[model samples]
Target: MSSLTMMPMSLEEIAQAVQGRLVAGTAAANTPVATSAFTDSRQIVEGSVFIAIAGERVDGHDYVPHVGAQGAVAAIVDHEIADADVPQIVVEDTVLALGLLAKHNIERRRALGTPFTVVGITGSVGKTTTKDLMKALLSHMGSTVAPVGSFNNEIGLPLTSLKVNAETRFLVAEMGANHVGEIANLTSLVPPDIAVVLKVGVAHLGEFGSAERIAQAKSEIIHGLVPGGLSVLNANDEHVAAMSAFAPGDVMWFGLPNGDGGNPAITAQHVRCDELDHPSFTLKNGDGEHAEVTLGICGQHNVMNALAAASVAMRLGMSIDEVASALSDVTTISPHRMAVSTVNKQETSFTLIDDSFNANPDSMKAGLDGLLRWKAGSESQPFRIAVLGTMLELGPDEKDLHVGIGRYALEGGVDALLTVGSASDASLDALAGAMADGASLAGDASHVDWVHDIDEADRLVTRLAVEHPGAVVLLKGSHASGLSALAERWQALAAQ
Candidate 1:
């Protein structure tokens, strides 16, 4: 559980930056502070500053003494702990103090007058993938710091932005939100010199109410950009494309050109996927410059992600060829997002497409499409098994959305469909029942089955692997669905 190593700041400097009073302990002001910051007591490395975050399930304040015992240099907490011998920086709000400390760190880096660039990316989907791509491309130019995973919220963004130092030249911040103004608040802390909005989807419909609200929420990144900053937008999405009107600075477009001569600054042409659904395309810029890029990853949706990253890199003075080379070399950095790996059971093996990290309507369709395309071009006919789990966060239309995906799977010609989880609370409106019913009614009942939970799904998955040799199994759903754990189980079984 070791966190990333960070530059050390003195105890006095940290307390001053957060505007907190060092109320306790006898540590010297000049002590080269903690090596890094920690929120969880168990993750505390020697000489780390622990920030006590208050949560409903667990109060981090209760763990102050625990982290202090683990050699923490200081603790930032809302309440003063009398028994704790460690230096305590008492603040009114620990969360706000964390953000203030992060902003102070960024300001210190800027005062050094170094060549630092911050690229902020926000979207309903593909934010992490695009962030990974941006990091790959930007890493070629200079020292870069992006989020560890989906660390794009208030707490995560500050933790990421605080990583920037004198040597860091590029910072890629992935911004995500469940409601309005969350991105705006994040942007206030780490405003971007460049902003990339991939797409606005219904990923958090339950929280935001409507797609328009989501679009509105995504546009906040544009408004929060630094003066004269650049915007990299997806021209294919109407909601994303519409964001260009709000851009105070210049804007660059990426995606497939409509060929009505609506040439974007960066685009993909001659796009095609291999039998394994790995995409290859010609990277074209507005000046008619183009280079053939063969991606090392699977999924056609990644083409748009690559284009977004390419646009950002090119804006920062990377040539078209350099962008293409860097992009083609990037395999899947994040796990379970179109990650293609093989699992062998005795004499036979199957290709496992683990897009089970998280899911929504848009991502679910993308995973299914990729799964279908992977099957289409294979020389050996492989049975496509889609073990779909519940897609959480859809408001009222969850049932219809789940049912639609089920129908889409049947129409996509998937063989042996399996849905996990129980029926909805009333009228069996649960996502599993809706999906299973859609498949059963669309095709033969024998081809579709519903399992009660992830354990049953795992057992069924093992059985399927044995029965159908060379089958391609796709695992897709939200984190709540637990398909990601199932995917890991399958991978471990294969390794055996």
Candidate 2:
């Protein structure tokens, strides 16, 4: 987590890199930009460059004047900023310009003869967690630069890549895509020395149209690798394992020992979780030297993510023991991904598993599995409640997917279920209702409930907290569901 000293880019060099024309304050073209570029004008500093992206609601060009007045050296814009005091680099598309600038930055770093390794990671799910884990493991060897949160798209990847300087030894580039060619373009911007494909689940099935298409999109990272670059594949996922044929170089497998056919270069054995659901396992490498890793993070699904990271670190010359020690030291990742917390209300307290960051069918099941493993520290069983919301972008069979998750929860012995929906959107309401119907049909009707929105869901959960002290509540859904906001509200109240 050490702060990086960004390599300076002159305003003239920036314009040439992005293929833009510098206007307004042309005298400052030689000004050395020793800081990072920003899309938000509010984050502008003395030496930073501002990228004016024309978003849907708010036009970044409107803030050009404000950023110029705040001492920004230059701004990259699609159109000329006439009144702004800072120089403007006009390009056909500001986003593309941003990518080009980042590409030049990475290439310049390489030309300086400093040793650097860029690892590109993509998958239908588990991309963010694996990125976080890899960052932790790589940081042990040298200074590392990784994106904050799930910054995996064009803008995010470039912004993260721009943070790399002469001193940085590792850059964990998280790449995500909603359709075909997105990951390929991202990989072109920052071609990885090592590529990691975690799993090929139906995360963005609606956008990509089919599972095979999703696999093809995810494989772009493997095909985009540099010459002699190694690919890390998940042996547990057949779709991902099949990508080995597209790799330009060797492939390293990581998964459970019982996975498909090939022996995983890195695997976890004897996996178990405690009452709070934090998993512990024996970390084993292909050479058979093993180390015990008791992860500080919750969820059994993360074992695969840890192994994926271990494979990369071991390939980069870190010992198996070093990888295990680093993995054990990581207590949490980006917020709301199986983040466990204790909420204390007026007279009762409950365990809250906030996996409300984002979800698909695969991740929803993983969240419920973590909830089912939770214990309340008494002889009697703990009351388990799952508060799920609409999982968007699931395509024509979205209802069937929601229903399947609800059935999975009830059949797996969940005590209660609350599905959140939008009172304003009937389509969303129907999806939530479908989940309720599935749970009721699978178990007792009295245990299933569908609330119109987060507000109503909150009231019911509050009452349930008072009635069932020490209950374990799980909040999971897509980002638009606002479930993470609800989790934050409860967490703030608990803190107070």
Candidate 3:
């Protein structure tokens, strides 16, 4: 919030951008607007503009007087609030008004003729990690701003864009969708200079209905690029690579060599993991360019993420060595995605891989693979334990997907699999049990156990770790299953 300088917009420009008429207060059109915009009154600082949004559970209009008392200069509302003290701009829909304001702000920045650029990213997984990596790498070049967390939706996108100003050099936007046209709508707010499509997977199969629909949703990012902008894609994903033709500009691909006679623009070769699963590989760019790079994060899956970010950095005039050094400096920015921690209790000591932010078929397998590969090369041959929870939004074939993940664990050489979720929630409990059942079918039944709750799973994992010293345990699941909470519990106990 306090990094770069933010220019305030005039009230007249806000009215013209949203086509709203200021119907109240004695404020003149030339008056300076607020410092920032917000829909939640609790975030309203001095000189903030309150945009009233009526959501499913609460209405922002109800907080008008509260924010005004807290020093809000004006309010953008859909209806006239009785006896509202501050100036009010009435629009048809406040959400659309917010987008219009962001679009105008972007255009205004473009009109300044500065070296501002917008890079948009969209994918089923790895979007957040890639965004964090790009932000860290790009920061070494110029001023960069991105969303706080998973702020990739309609409301989140515009809020991030509102922070852009004259001195802003690069803006990294994360676009996400649950349906076909969601990304398209977000792209309209701020057209991108460089579009990155990570992968087209079934993360939201329930809402999208099919992987094909999900692919279409992901391609919207490419379609929304500005004229002659570049496209960075994952060559390993056929659905993603095929999107190149749809882009309005040239494309750059990143992935490991497929050995099908296709050389990606950026590639990682001779990939190796250390004792803690940190990957080191030779980075190869187009035109016989190569650099020996090492990553601080612990995941084979993240190698693809590194390639995507490095491709962007290279295209933006950064040398391969600089990109490698920047990437190597980053261990893990965002939490709960392959986040590694060492637990050194008196009774038990092991490493914990906390990937408990969210889960799907693709990410669950990726995390499990990382857990297996981490211990594969170690002399200790640590017992690799995967404590998995429910993967939500997998559609009607959820049972099959869970079973397949279980089989993946067994085939990937996981020594023990512990499944946990809500017991009272019959659907999730059954899903976790189904995962354990599938793993039991592949290996010894005693190695796979499904607990109906987190407490039992926590006790089981602690007991297992004490039983097998120096073991590596992984916690992977959606946020609802409380696997992240269990990880936090272990972290706090370790701190003590």
Among the numbered candidates, top lDDT falls to 2
Residue pair clashes in candidate 1 = 424-430
Off by over 4 Å in 2: 1-5, 32-34, 259-262, 376-378
Candidate 1: regions farther than 4 A off? 1-8, 66-71, 346-348, 422-429
- The ten-residue window of minimal lDDT in model 3 covers 1-10
lDDT of 3 by residue, 1-496 (tens): 4432234776666877888987656754356466677778888777777889999999999888667778787889999888776778889999999888888878888999989889999999999999999999899999898988778999989888877877788999999998889999998999999999999888989888898889999999888999888999999999998898878989999999999898798999999887677889999899688888889888878899899999998999899989989999998678788888888776788888989989999999989988988857656698899999999888999999999999899878898899996878999999998999889888777889999888998778888898888888999998888898888888886677
| Candidate 2 vs candidate 3, lDDT winner | 2
Q: What is the lDDT of residue 296 in candidate 2?
A: 81
Rank list by lDDT = 2, 3, 1
Q: Judged by lDDT against the true structure, how good is candidate 1? A: 0.85
Question: Each model's number of backbone clashes?
Answer: 1, 0, 0
Clashing pairs in 2: none
Off by over 4 Å in 3: 1-7, 28-30, 56-58, 83-85, 344-349, 494-496
Q: Global lDDT of each model?
A: 0.85, 0.88, 0.87
- Cα shift from native, residue 369, model 3 (Å): 1.2
If candidate 3 were superposed on the true structure by all CA atoms, what would the RMSD be?
Answer: 2.1
